[model samples]
Target: MIAPPARPDSLVRQDRFTTDESTADVAVVIVTYRNADSISTLVDSLRSEAAVSSIRVVVVDNNSGDGTASTLAAHDDVIVVAGEVNLGYAGAINVARSRIGATRAVLILNPDCVVQPGCVTALRAALREPGVVAAVPRLHDVDGRLSFSLRREPRLPATLVDAMLGARLPRRPVWASETIRDVAVYDRAHSIEWATGAAMMMSAGALDAVGPWDERFFLYSEETDYFRRLRSHGLVLYVPEARVEHTGGGSGSSQALSDLLTVNKIRYVQKYHARSFVTAFHAVTLFGEAVRCWSSKHRATYRAVARRHEWSNLLRAETPRPTECRDMGSVVIPAHNESRVIARTLDALADLAARGVVEVIVACNGCTDDTARIAAGRPGVRVLDLDVASKTAAMNGADEVAELWPRVYLDADVVITPAAVVDLVTALADGTLLAARPASRYDATGAGHLVRRYYRARSSLPLVRSHLWGAGCYALSEEGHARVGRFPDVVADDVVVDAAFATDEKIVVDTDPVVVLVPRTPAALIAVLSRNYSGNRDAPATTSSTGTLRHVAGTVHGPGTLLDAAVYCLFAALGRRASRRTSARWARDDTSRT
Candidate 1:
């Protein structure tokens, strides 16, 4: 892994970003509190993505003592604003928005949310559809479990139902229904009433028309109120194909920030409903919460926060949004004695660039053939020739381009599709350290299909550490390469590089197939695997030697291991049978179609 670049003397400064005046189509705002550990990841993701052409990331730090301000200042792309105090979520967002003059849309994201590649693009596309005032992507947890962030607006009766009977009453049965009409389960793609603010994208037009978020309510229900207001104006909220992993609950110290939550809920009801309903609803709900808290021994904590008369003041504090610093990145492709394959790779890249994928910088190393010539012929593809034959040396030499922009290392033999590049860029945009795709090998016998299916299943297991595989066809942001240092000069350079970042950095394997072309022969396969084993031998063991030995023994003898082995054998046998049937069906289909 490459080391992060040195912090600039002074972070970039902007007056204010305006939705009307700004050329950027989207602006992402992250309200952060003590997020020093995760802020860099967020900025890195934004900087490396190519799908989002023009973006401004505003990070509002809520007076965190966690070195968050300095960390945000390190990035050229982020606008870091430090709050005077720990302002609640709404206050911090307002502070951030004060600096953002205008944008086509405002993307409200939690500091911990890691958006998949192309998620923003999908959200932007969804927002463009008529009447969509706001839209949210599907949210997943850290463990990749889906979190149903989309929900219907809470009615007064539903709130009363919950307040009176609690979980016993089937209040909000709309969420429970599994039918297609129930927006939660209808995954194919459709509209919805409201999505969680963990990662919501709202049109600038809608935001301006609705005015600022009601400052009376701080964190929760702020989104609910915003959605309700948008709906009142006859605009619709939607859930798009985009996805984000929300690490929820960043501000509060305990699970029961119940008083603050209750206060906000009361404020929301007061703002939207009639006085009678608000009074009745607030009384019942507060009483219900009081009962629950008393039973759960959380009444004191709730009462203490509510005792503070300045609860409303907590919602109004403002902070400025972080400014985006320019982060330039370069793409480095190391080519060997390839002339034929190099052109195809260059063509695919050119297509990507044409579609606004990424800027390319090709480094042709140890090519005895016309690899340099072919690379130079392509527009925007810079050719770097190295006299040495070593792959590690070629990659190290390519690091020279890192001086200009963050560098992404690419191999010449692999062809990256445009969609794959978009996916990778999107993942990088959301702050993934290293992003890659499974290598799709071509085969006429359908063995490739079977291998891919099995590989995917195995890869999804919790025990599997994906970065153990070498960087077959991968893209690393310049910052990632710099932080990680140069690729280790070894026979298995990729494996060594993977090991370097496996622990600290996020290595994302996008669902898309970025590299088409895998080892075709047994010799090629053995060479790759042997190099990996060699790297593994040289690499520092994460566990103790005793543990390692025990693990190895278990793999050879344990029942779970034995079962997995048996499953693999069964799958292989079944795949052969399935392949024969598929071939026969394909032949019949071809005959019928002809």
Candidate 2:
């Protein structure tokens, strides 16, 4: 296959088309909503176009319930399509075009658009070029400024940058976002990856070749995918001579639109990109959303994006063949007053603990809340309520009850994915690594400024490169557990476990991850850091950290990364100072417990 020729400095010039002399119909398809004012304005704009004779206008109303269909019905030539239910924009456009059957060209327009004089003439003329399948008019905002109507394919760095910092940065970076770079060609009539669906026209031949617009994409990226499909067969031209002023925020400003925009973006990426790229895309997008979510305006949207299951649904297999939880033995969780989040934690672990496959023990020690009651309520969970309030005692009690090889030490607040648990067990079955831990990702919802920056900075490091030093979930074979025997009376159980396993004996589960909840405020961060420092003082030196030369160089990402490092160091010093006041033997930071 040959590549398309390079676009010239300008589109090929053609004579203006005033009338349709050929026996073909030029159909105008408008998908409208609570857009009465725009529709009335569009009527006036369409009336002034002298060259658009014999054109048909069809309006597909998406249950706006605003009496828009009744108003459009009064027009003698307009076809009104009012339905009881809402078909999203792409679906509505499909309905409108299908109703206006066998058209020579279909011009799709948003209701809030005003066509300049001779605009339709220019677009129609451009469509007549040798191999051009579609044409889009140069679009400006209500104020006539160039909008970001053109695009390259959606990419990880570009989308993340656009989300974190809005497209128009004061000083553009060396790796500028796609939206920023696309501005250079906004004024030139040239080929593009895709133009906004708001004001684009498609030839009948193009529609026939590509079939109907994919309804799977309920709203956004429908046009992008459609244009991509069209480009696979023929060319798309941007006609600068033809101009349209768009009052852009139709579905855009709706509060409910954010979720749709997010899922559809993922859907587009998963459909087009490979699995490896999809995982990288999800990580970048989530971290960017998490950073920007600290702002009240975008908090809800980013929170939705932050849900791990949302990405796993698309990233993981649809029908995940149930994994065998491996022959290696028991799962032990130590809890103290964890009623609020214990249900979710155990719920995440239930499938793997099915019917004695793995002994599930929850050692609830000195809980002043209903944690013991709640954990005991789970079908496969065995809860033991001890008298003392100590994680060390709880672990010892759990070890006595479980008494099996390859024990899983887990925290009550963290949610361990069942599939990941199975994967870790299977990974250790080969006996190459004596002990293993699932890599962790911190859930940063409601985190303070310093804490937020820290996690976001940490996101740039390798996903599973760290050792199993202090992960939320780690498994130990009998040989591994014997190396670090019965729970020692220490501040951090994970620290002792890490000290026992050499770098070669421990494996970091890279495929599936374990999710942990991050502390909420700066004080909470200092508390956790203090305990960590106290725990490590008596423990062995860690063979892992976020301070490799590669990591330090990568930390030169923005002000945020540097700030994260600064804050992390400051808190470490503060924690060490604070640890002097607290008991070194028993310190577990549970600031996030509710």
Candidate 3:
């Protein structure tokens, strides 16, 4: 645990104080809500030598029922302002802004955030640049994953595109999240449209010009509206060379809060746009909300809030017009012997395809039954029949039929989730050869989570080479496929094709996972794993003997590395146990059938 900076003043001051002898001029305000557990850490992080020597710290305890006041009282550097009741984020920040006074800059930080060393200095330096109104630091989740802190203000059309079709229509799929793309393209010195309120610094001059956050938005969309206001004044938002760790959703978690977020989003649209814009925005948002409420597990709460808002918006007269764009890519499913689940898969694919992300290609590979005929029965679907047993061969067949068009490969048995295909295709960048779709299991066995983690960890390692590409689902560039000499005819063609490229040239995986029905019977699981192991064993070794030895040793005894060999052995034992059970069940079923 990091320690807080020592207090320079004898006593904590309530009102803003001027220090003529300042090195870097800025003040940071953090608002807390029942965050006593993490307040000390947050205060310490903000009061670190790098932050304290340059900036002031203001801790706003939003009438937290927890012992939040005591936590702030212990920190001498923190000027604790206790609210009478639990004020929402916008209200709390507004209170802090009043005490911030005339500093060169003001930083809005969350209580659960910890600034990386020198982050304040970097943000302040970035703001000093001309035309830059605010500079937000790159924020990472507690697990050191990048948060989508930077973003374009959400428009109704963009929301519809994202909700219905997917990000593929954006032309830059790699920039699905506003923050990651902003960090990648915009330099430490470049500008952006908006950023997350998790950790953002604004110049005092800009704040004075644009004014405070829109208080009407009690929670969400306030920052978005603020950035809009800032842009109106010709001040651009900049992302500087700074990093902050954010513990996601520390303050708001209640169903009430979730409803508030939904309602406030509507309020944001109403506040910013004209009557015409508001009308169209409300229509799309309300429709989307109704669908969301109906489908959500928390239907009672979501529906109640959504219906109320919809009724309120219905009385309004004028509405805004929506933007339109060209739809790209066809979702292509290749099937063989999928009579049981072919209709369901096609149905799900059709719903997604209707979003205009990609066209559906249900290429029937070596199917002697109604798989091809069933697929052809669907409207707007072009079905192709192919007499190929190999997975790679099937893909090749699909490619030949859909020549020059980008295609997404979907397995016959797998169920694609809502917007998953769109998300995958939209996230594709210029150099990305393939985009790996995430897979979720039908059962909540936690195996999918572990598999995802394993894939992510292994993918990051420079030594681990990917040869066994998953045939379940993945998208490939038609040109990129041709460039890479097409998919190889191997047992596990996906892995084989994945290994052909350099690590940097392979398909990138996203968090939006596809749902896969795991083998319910142990025999099926073992068969899949055995086939995978066999494919891996037969594939030529990509790593040298020396590298393999090093990998083994690292698995055995490396700092921070778990005993993976033992773990692998344990999983193998579990597989054996499952196989025995499966065999017994199969024997009993056979006897009954006879």
Candidate 4:
């Protein structure tokens, strides 16, 4: 698996993005943080573009407490999404990309930049070139002079030269300088390694192929990383005719931002190059900062490079860190011979771990398969090999090791996204709620007709919606953990957690729904239901107070659902009978696993 780029809490919050669907051919996506005063000029400038009629303006305000919301509200034609938390530049761009629908191309612009007339038209023309995925516009400073926005890939030889003689060396040779300063190069369209991210255009296909921006650099090298990825698919063309006047010097001038810039340059090198090359790149970058230490920003950069191991801490200082409770939460996944599904579960949690959102521990019990190996390969995920083949034993073992509070216990087959996990963690952070889980979304695409009907009826029941037991994923705070103490040897671990909390103490978070896949065949469905029934029998007596009849009763309202309710009841009865007749053993539906 490709390692997720580590940015300072890039995925810190569940993005609260809302936008409209438009038939516009081009989407102008602007990611802004605290630039309310300057964004209006940029947005208004796009209105005068030659192809303004085909352009849909999308502004993603990254939780800027400034009046950016009010400033954007004035533009009725623009689509504005205000995030609840600061998702950094790359994260906000990702959110904006998701909302672009079927637009032909996306032009990413900084709020501080104004596009000249015909800029979008020229960019679209360049984007239409065969084998071209990205087109970057030539940027001019507010004073109307060219801002050397083009750059060469960071090479050890060029970096060393820059370190020996400062980066501003006017006549530095092309091979020794990282910046592309030849005036002739910007006079006409050409290909480039990368360009300044202030104004860049990409086809929608390029955006889809390149996937997400490497959010590891909160404000710096993310664009470089993305540009490199875009180059892998096709050419990154420079469109000199496309002019954008940029107002620089906000984050770029700050000492902290400069520190990040230096560190992220080294990070970009480390991600793509061998260790030997990364070592050389780091040494050169550090030397350059050391020589220029007279300036406060350079000193900050030097110190940042010196303490490279604490980069995450440095990033935390720059960005608002997640709540202490969020940092302290742990996700415990119990896997027993689950090689088939363990990777899927861990992949969901990888982003959470990369963002420092939670600690993940996968306790593999009696696994003859490669479950433990697969889980260990995931970033920020811990793996344990338990001797017994018991789910309760695995959970208990994981709980013993997980010192953090608000522990989330996830089933190996369940696929819960990082955003949904954040929602559950957020809900559990509330002083009143001790336990939480996301709403359930059952995938019964390949299930038998009767089984699908049974799930349809069962999913509509108020008891299922309100209870935390059926979701396969659930979280418990310290107090909630004390109530459930040690997981008993029961089939339904979720049921135990659910029973531990009173009605007011538990909640179902309204985030992205947790996808729960139903068994494919009728027999397989019954086998899973039978296992659930067996778990229910082993749960505390209080959990059984609500009888099967009561739950089935809620599924029936009119004649339409009456058939579904009957199927649900029949399955429940059959599962109960099967559970009573069969000896206590693990009975999972392997059909979905296959």
Candidate 5:
């Protein structure tokens, strides 16, 4: 019999990330708590991925005062978001997703992971099939030794066995027989219950359908929750033909986080498994706790985790609400400096708020003006003043504080009637649509040839015809919010939300038309178009979600639309060229401002 390859000799460590960045096709999210040393080495390895088109690196520094953000700040390609409060691993990932915008695939990675050449390629290739939600690469330890990378869900029998024997013997195959087989037989790729969030290339479409990570889980069981959400959507979790070295052991030393992990695990078991299973798990865990009491080295860490209150929360029949329940349907409007139009937007939805069907949450992010004060003045409109300017962050902050579902992500600039808000909530109540957005009527009176032509041609398409996004506003059903949790930190959140569902699952609710302000001038059009282009930067260039005929038919409404299409083509070519020259903070069209 052939013996397994021996672990490679250790190498010297020199920490650095190369300046070279690809034309990013993937948004690589690295949520670091600390371990700046490990992250530096991993970044260096990632720089070697020149074969990959583009890698957008979003480093969410979860208040790691150890200067991890500053360490990565020098790298031009890296976008670092300061989590002044550690949003935990799951929350960080959700923030990273928004920052990623609309990339074809998202890579959820650990700060300590290093990938081999073609690893990303294989992961991306696996996601080409529609059924595959995520693809995990095989993991090797720093020593290039194969670690225990796969396992079935924790069962009571396995737990009892591992506690009774595996804890003591340390190498008994009988303790975790199936897990042992998984490691031994891992010669090829296969389906798994969940992939380690350490390094997995997930389909953006799948993420849209599954939503964001459940922020309730601090760290440990986040992947399990993600898997559960994905599985609920009938998506497959695939293992691809590639390998990555994920240095096991995160900032796992934090006793608080570790305790939370233990609690999350118990909750996971109780939530998914049977009552008997939970009882068995607690019994098995007690045995392990008893074993730990005999081991002096583990007493502190073990005692910190095995708390009665934490266990009781899970064993109880009722689930704890994430936030207060003053409201049922939530309308979260993320604003930066929209003091001019904030009141009007709030007034439009005042009827729904008055009826008690909705509560408006104006998350005023990075507002220097009286946006918050003005929003707060409105009766029934709750104002959330945020320090960060990110729309995704504001939405997340709102989600964090408000225990409301069937959330509506309303754009401050769009003007939709209160009746429309009522219709949206009513539509959401039926559970027919994953998401719904109003049909738009563009303000074309003051527009130029190119600008008017673009909107006219766009209006003919499915976005105006049968699809969404032409309108700035959209509503998420409770199921929609459940499937796709928090808003990602992105400029074009509508596109990201719109991509998460099929036509059958979502709709263009034209009951009450939404008035969209078109760019008044060619210059304004260029500025707005440039921003729009930037919004679409990392997103899929094209998606089959909307068919070809739907795309073309949008341009053929009338002879006038044919002329509109001609001008639109001219501007599109010109716009694409000008868009490249746009800076990160591109100019917005002020034509809509009253």
Candidate 6:
């Protein structure tokens, strides 16, 4: 007989630091992810707040690879729960709250945020008000600029209007926008539908009535789902007297997180609203993504919305099991004339190869230099001297010899650490995912001013870092290879591989990023972008040249991004024009290669 499905409570282990029998007036729960750098300041401020009121501090570390748990453990007044698995934000909050004693109110906080003097006291006071289920503090960035933290109930009309008119429209009708833009509204305490989850205080009774935060929403919309539930009980009050200095993006940002944020909005509507509303919400979301589908993130979201049944698995918190193989996998490096950069790249993988964690293969395709000798000199490294100069041909040649189930295709010029390769291999060991790549960290060292400015804008886009391409490396499971088939004879082989899989089938693994060196000069940068343009022209991408223009135009959020966008657009236009006029030969950037 088939058993019923299990509940999605993902917390496997919880540890309490303080065993005090005495209850506190409020419990402050901070969810951390590699936030050891900022956790000290937050803890210091909360320690000061403890002088005015009885407060119990609790920190739940969400399986951070950094020493966040150890840092929190050093605090005697704090209760720290070092999670074995990643219990996202909502699940971490639920876990932290369970360890608290009889507290009147519970405060949720981001690790990279700090509360000002009397802020917690104000929030606790506001939470105690009549008919108030939750209270939120006014949030500001480190620059002291006010954040539009409050939002209206996420309905179809607001979503549609925001999608059409965009969010920057002034004096927008309150019903047509989810974000509350009026500064006057933030001056005084008032009721709100919901606010940012970076910092909030909720009554213990309201929390109990609403039940635990829905962990299925994962990291993004779980708070929205909770607040919607809280509205049934009472109001969510905004306390202007309370302020939090937020160093946003503390937990980090990725294409996956951005896609999660977009898809979960529709998921929320689907949970409470009718079928028609759900369909409309989905359509509005797709329209928004469609408008910006040139952007990597929006393109990814468009794909996510297009594939409905698959994206729901992203909400699952089940951890991947370890594989039986002692040597994790094989790594294939495809090189043409990368002699200058091949040593550094091979040196980065030497430790992993020597440790028997990964077997390294360097496919030197049509190389005249000592690229083959440099790689062959390294222990546990195999060199394939291919006659053709095609990158895809080199990849296919290495694949013919690669015996591992999950194989990594690395560019000869990219530098990736052994730890990141191990993590990436572990992520693919379970065979649930088809493709994965570590995040990218671009080194702008020796880059010209125009090149620097162009990459500055490009790096700000979540898609450039999140997508499998551009990061200089991507891994594919045996199943992924079956789907992608053989390496195509195209300049945009990465694009072809990326297009073959849906958003759910691929991921940008959270690990040490591969280092991609920027072009040293503006001309070299344009030459590389010209190659990209040629590749995009040859490949079957979701975006077009016009879509690319709109995507770059859509990135202009304010004055700072405006200058960057202009530089980026100028280079993009030049690159496209150059690619059209030039021959179909590889317009490679020898600057970084040298």
Best by TM-score: 4
lDDT of 4 by residue, 293-369 (tens): 78877887787876542454444212322333347589999899999988877887777776667899999999999
Over the stretch 1-594, how does candidate 3's per-residue lDDT look in tens digits? 889987665345323333334533777788888999987887667655332445677777777878989877876656679977655676678778777655788888888888887887877777777777788887788898767666766666566655453334444454333323433553454577877778888888888898656444556777888888888766565554688899979866766666666666656765555556765765665555555554563464445343431222221111111112224465667676666778887787665455544567777778888888888887767787888755567767777676424456777776775445554554343434443443332322334434333333332232432232542676666554665566666655555555555544443332234555544344444454455544554455566646644554544424323434434344444544554444221111111111
Worst 10 contiguous positions by lDDT, candidate 1: 585-594
Estimate the TM-score for candidate 4. Answer: 0.55
lDDT per residue for candidate 6 within 1-594, as digits (tens), equals 999786554221122222476777788888888998999889888866776767888888888979988887678778888888886787778778678778878888899898899998899888777899899999999999999999987778889888777767857878888999888899999998999889988888987898767665668888888888899999999999999999888858887787788888876776667656776888898898888866887788787775543453454343322222357889999998888999999898887787677888999999998989888999989999999998999999989988886889988889987756776776677787889887677788888888888987787663564368888889998899899989988887788888888766787765566889988998888788888888877777766667666766766758977989889989988888888888765876788866
Per-candidate Cα lDDT values, in order, are 0.58, 0.71, 0.59, 0.79, 0.68, 0.81
Residue 189, candidate 3: how far off, in angstroms?
Answer: 4.1
TM-score of each: 0.46, 0.49, 0.46, 0.55, 0.50, 0.52
Writing each residue's lDDT as its tens digit, candidate 1 over 89-140 gives 7767777777776578888888887877778788888878876777778877
The worst-scoring run of ten residues by lDDT in candidate 5 lies at: 315-324
Error of 2 at 167 (Å): 2.1
Worst 10 residues of 6 by lDDT: 9-18
Which ranges of candidate 3 are over 4 A from the true structure? 1-24, 49-52, 165-183, 186-189, 290-294, 297-594
User: What residue pairs are clashing in model 4?
Assistant: 6-216, 7-216
User: How many pairs in model 2 have backbone atoms within 3 A of each other, for residues 3 or more apart or on separate chains, i.e. clashes?
Assistant: 0
Off by over 4 Å in 1: 1-22, 48-50, 164-172, 175-188, 290-297, 301-594
CA RMSD per model (angstroms):
23.1, 15.3, 21.4, 23.7, 24.1, 14.1
Q: State in Å the error of residue 496, model 4.
A: 35
lDDT of 5 by residue, 1-594 (tens): 999776643211112222244335677889897867777777667766634445677788888888787788767667788876776777678777767765777887888888877787788888876677777888888787876655557777777776566535535563363254444455776667665668877777777888767554556777877876776765454453588888888756555554555666665775466556766786676676567577653464365444332232221101111222235577888888998887888887776666666788889999999999988888778888889888789888988876666677887887777646655655565576688875457778866767877877765553344445657788888788777667665667777777777656775543456777888877777677677678776444434524634564544636876787777666666666778886664465687676
**1-594: candidate 2 lDDT, tens digit per residue:** 999997653233111221233433467788987776678667556655533544667788887778777777666556788856666677677677657765778788899899888787788888898889899999888788887677778777777777677656724653456553445666677776787888888788887788766554657878888989989977899998889999888764644476557756766776567657876776776666677666764676665665433333222222112344344467888898888889998898786666555678999999999999998888878999999998879988988878566778888887877656665665566566788887677778888888887666555444323456546778887778778877777766776887687666876653355677888888888777777777777776653444443554554646766787666556656877888878754545566665
Candidate 6 has an lDDT of 0.81
Best by lDDT: 6
